[model samples]
Target: MNLFAEIRALVIQNLEAMQSEGVLPDGLDLGNVTVEPPRDAAHGDMATNAAMVLAKPAGLKPRDIADALAGRLVADDRIVSADVAGPGFLNLRLAPVVWQGVVGDVLAAGTGFGRSDMGQGRKVNVEYVSANPTGPLHVGHTRGAVFGDALASLLDFAGHKVTREYYINDGGAQVDVLARSVYLRYLEAHGQEVAFPDGTYPGDYLIDVGQALKDKVGDTYVGQDEDVWLEDIRNFSTDAMMDLIRSDLKSLGVEMDVFYSEKSLYGTGLIEAAIEDLKSKGLIYEGVLEPPKGKKPEDWEPREQTLFRSTEHGDDVDRPVMKSDGAWTYFAPDIAYHYDKVQRGFDALIDVFGADHGGYVKRMKAAVSALSGGTVPLDIKLCQLVKLYKNGEPFKMSKRAGTFVTLRDVVDQVGPDVTRFVMLTRKNDASLDFDFDKAVEQSRENPVFYVQYAHARVNSVLRKAADAGIDTNATPDLALLDHPAELALAGKLAEWPRLVETAARSNEPHRVAFYLYELAGDFHGLWNKGNDETTLRFIQEDDHAGSVAKIALARAVAIVIAAGLGILGVTPADEMR
Candidate 1:
């Protein structure tokens, strides 16, 4: 029931008719032809660029083509009027019945009304919040978790088979630091005083993990040296930290379909295999790299190292896969991780990384491009920092995470819904300001509340109508819905299918959030109009059939709002009170 699509099809059909009549030349590329809502609603219901795009190709003037196209379009019952705008744009106003049909289609399709098959069941792997298996997830990972989860749902709605993945960086030196930190807490559990040095984690979150270790194996590693206990404690501590991270994510309504272990890439030959794939393409070689642009390391001597010819793809410089000391560089394992994703037969890969990892983006894409032989497309989204405020001042740090706020801290302060919604209010690349004072406020200024109140108001109308003995179960007589206000709401409803396709095509889930807000605003405006004009009210006291038709319109809005919120992992509010 995409009215824009339907209108575009009609335009293409008319163009084909014109070509057959030899009015326009054959073989004009119509790929660039687009039909969308006019910028100014007063101009028309929809506009098409078909005339402008085909004019030069057909060796005809834009206005001439537009005049011919307009004539063919108005012949159809759906199109009430068609006029040529500047140069060659075709602006169209649909018949009133057309808008009524859109509302009816929404009720019939229900929540699946806007679902798109644009992705065509392609497999996509989305990896996010791969926070080191060290301690509780902090505020930084919260943005990525919400963004990735919403994006997975969006892709799924657009018809992509998506897998939500979290890569456990257990093979890194950070996990070893976590192991030693937990060992100190373990000693403290055994009644031994311990001091956390500069590199050790001093957070009290590890205190319970240490006690758990003692409970599992009492006195086994007591007074043991690093060589004897390091490996076992590393595995044990990392598992416990992952459990903490999983709990943190669950509290925020995030669930991962896969948790890939970096350690698995180590013991197995996956790294060798991934590098071998690149080597076969003559992309891997032993070479020396120029020191990084801004800063050179203290040990800055140029030495031969295993490098990937990332420059051939799109990276600014070739990147090192192995250090001079024969140890796998950090980039090597990441390359292997992406290779594993490609081997799993996913048609696309999306990585949600923190802003600091922006420098790592190009090389990572180059690796996936080379490994997948450009068959798999990879997009890396960088979530910027979040600034927290309370009582109009900067929020204090958590004693648990020591230097930053934990995800649990934000969730506990305001429930997951507010946290998730406010987090998405900004673009992933822009810095987000999460205000403790304003987000939970039950006022129109708060977007979360504003949008939820709109949904709740619709529910209120249905409940009141039911109490007033208006037969709410009757099918809406959509033909009676021809008022300007009703038609306006229906026109907004018609944009949902197109919005979903565009948002999913760009891999941008924030567009969903923005669309939901605009829809809510339109709905709220219509509701307010009912206050001054009794006829615009959803419930007509004396007319049961007209009331059912209006209620149907309100219900249709609620249905799409709930579906959009579901995609964002947000629970639709039933009542504001």
Candidate 2:
């Protein structure tokens, strides 16, 4: 059903034939050969670099190879013409029937039209939005959550066995701060006035957690010291915060398959086990690190610490696993967590981190490399900051979150679909400006609206045809779809399968949003063309067969858009309000 793949196979078959006929050399590496859309539509429908890629290897002139290949390519019924462009690039114009067939294929496949098997069922673990379970998620974590969830969906569509995971940062000092904050709230719930110190959380969200604790214990821990209540409250508060986070994610349509607890790695010997695995490979040692660059020797006090030889596995320097006080460093638990992932037998690991964690990438990669013995590949994607603007100024922070806007604030303002689509309109590493006014705007300038309008327009066409009593269920005569605009849309639809494969290979889910925008543009372009020419309209008056064929084409476009939006975790719009 992938026309480009079928055409490429044809080209390869013809090349093999040429080799047998001695028209070309016996062997030429064709791995780099590629077929894609021509840079300019004026050139041709599709373009191939096969001639250019093989010319030097075969010891033949570029034009000479192109000429021979063009003749063999035209012999197929699909390709009508193959013309050589500058320096042996072959531009191909497929027959109208070939483009027409793509519409029928889309109709038959529905939303599954672009699903690919490129991953070949390899197990991939995508860990994202591993924010500290101290409070509800913020705007930064929102971007990471959407990016990771969409990536998991994209991998699944591309045939990978994906596990959506969230790592709870409950083992760190942050949770202790949260427990103390809740304890103050608990005192307030017991009719005691309390002032939150600088180090504790002051958000009103904890007020309920305090009251709930009172409801459960009923004055059991009243006026107790930190030693008696800290442990119990830490566990209790973490569970409450996680519940809030889960509810926030569900509101945004993100659900994780696993919520990994960082506390489990502690007191479980997992950290020691992970470090021992590194020790067995001679990667662990005790040494004093050199003073950081630009630091005067007199100002630096170097301490001997237990370190991992991360430099051997591509990190900039060796990393310390244990602090001078003998407590595990922050990086130790992270290493153990990733080692556990590798031990779970995943073929690949992907971590979605906030932009501030860019410096931590190399060390984490080194840890996974050493733990998996270079077997599992780790790809870390860092999502940059999101700047919110509204009413010609910066958006106000959420009072509930205390310091930043919560994910629920964004979702509540412009439902989940718009929030998800607008978040992905930019690349993960690039900073994004999420303007409240512009996100819900109904104009071509807004990409989410533009794409959704296209789907809604198609539904309108089907509804109108149904009301007119046109038998759309009848087999569509695809041959009647011979207009230039109709064929152009079909050509765009043909690119879907290839687009999915490329996006999945690069681990970029934003490309799906980009492609949906382009597809919508093509569809809207054709829809507008019907205004100038009566014959170009999708529903031809009194011509049932002709209308059915064109309606079939429009339906096909909607199918692919829904499929693309589905991968992005946005529900496709059936009607625009």
Candidate 3:
């Protein structure tokens, strides 16, 4: 149960009672009213802005409403004290039984304790890791992949029907380059000496794809001209690349529910239909874009192109959909892709893109707005670059990738759990410094290890209690948990339900990582305290009843930590070597 929500309901109910008693007006809007944990825990357990938000609307003084609301709230069984504070903020202290019940709730719910219904079963499509299939994913794409996968899991835990998707960039000139690159590799497989031209891929990963082609088609296009082999090789190479990409993602613990093909939009008239819809809405028009403000030259001339009125929604300027030569611009298929998402009947859409694609956000949102008629909402999250370090120096390129650090390089070096956890240690929009050496260090400096240690410590306690013959099945006597350290841990546990809703509302999965770290810190702090105080020890040598109660609390922390890690797609460590 969400204690914060329960208290907020109490406040709302009391305000409704105040309306009946004429202490507040009847038709006041209460949407902005909120109940949350007080910034200073010493002040109280929770605080509400019911009075401050209602004061101006109801034409009543803030203090007057707060005092009346406080009196009514304290009458509830869960509320031990409610005090009106500065500017009519009401701080509430819940009964000890309330904190005590959180342990039972965690045990009862297990991994599902913090799961929320904030999404209300709404369908959400989270499209991420749409890296061009011309090559294996790099470190930059790894962050986006982990972020998107975790976000999908988080949304699912928050009651959203989430669909994880990947958009293939196979319809562009890049894939044509990929086709020619593979043809060269295929020639090399036949023992022909070939030099990779400027635009052809030189990575060794394609060497296998080349051999596979030789095995399948055996001299069919061995010496054919570009026109004869280009089309067949393009399709063949992309399928092989996608297969390699899929394996790479699987290695990193990411699985996509859908892999949408951009090439499919070409032959099916989808791009034309998407643009036609925009044309029907008067959003598409023939226009000449202004030249760059400072770079307008004497020879600069206005060129007419088919543009989408992106500014009408929220973009800085209208964007081109088709070039002056009648070819669809790069933005056309993206628009059609989102339009397809809208047609799929998703209530919301989210795109996780690399930070370099920041410029595309506004226009893409504008397209979704016009296509969905402002009904469905789209949220674009851009993951910034990851700078890698090893031995306190800049890490060099991967030999296998033949260029930058591949996702597999990172995952193989530190394993999937460390890679996923470290990738999320920073906000998506913030640049992350991933140190291969420090990420694996088992110390407080490493957040992933620190958090895992907390889980491991909890398991250690359970093991000790079991060996001591303590009956862990006994119902925990939470009244015995009166120490301040114990209470602090309960307070952290109480924030889970609220934290899940907040993170989901903001669409920030990093917040879950941050919360779990803080929760782990509190749990560890409490465990460390028991090191000096014998009574605080989880396993009492002669007090089996008290030992069971304390073990129950430790297990409760593990339950929440496991649940949080589950949302992050990282497995909890029961034993850390």
In terms of lDDT, the poorest run of 10 residues in model 3 is 479-488
lDDT by residue (tens digit), candidate 2, 492-514:
99999988888999899999999
How close is every model to the real structure, measured as TM-score?
0.98, 0.98, 0.98
lDDT of 3 by residue, 1-577 (tens): 7888888887888888889998888999887889998989899999999999999989889999999998888888988899999889999988877887888889889989988888999999999999999889999999999999999999999999999999999999999999999999999999999999997899998999999999999999988899998999999999999998999999999999999999999989899999999999999999899997796899988999999999999999999999999999999999999999999999999999999999999999999999999999999999999999999999889876788899999998999999999999999999999999999998898999999999999998888777878878888888887777887788899899899989898899999999999999998898888889988988888887788878888999999999999989999999999
List CA RMSD, all candidates: 1.3, 1.3, 1.4
Clashes of 2: 0
lDDT of 2: 0.94
Residue 198, model 2: Cα distance from true site in angstroms:
1.4
User: Each candidate: how many clashes?
Assistant: 0, 0, 0
Query: Which number leads on lDDT?
Result: 2
Residue 425 in candidate 2 has what lDDT? 97
Candidate 1: give the clashing pairs. none
Instruction: Report the CA-based lDDT of candidate 1 relative to the real structure.
Output: 0.92
Q: Model 2 misses residue 514 by how many Å?
A: 0.8
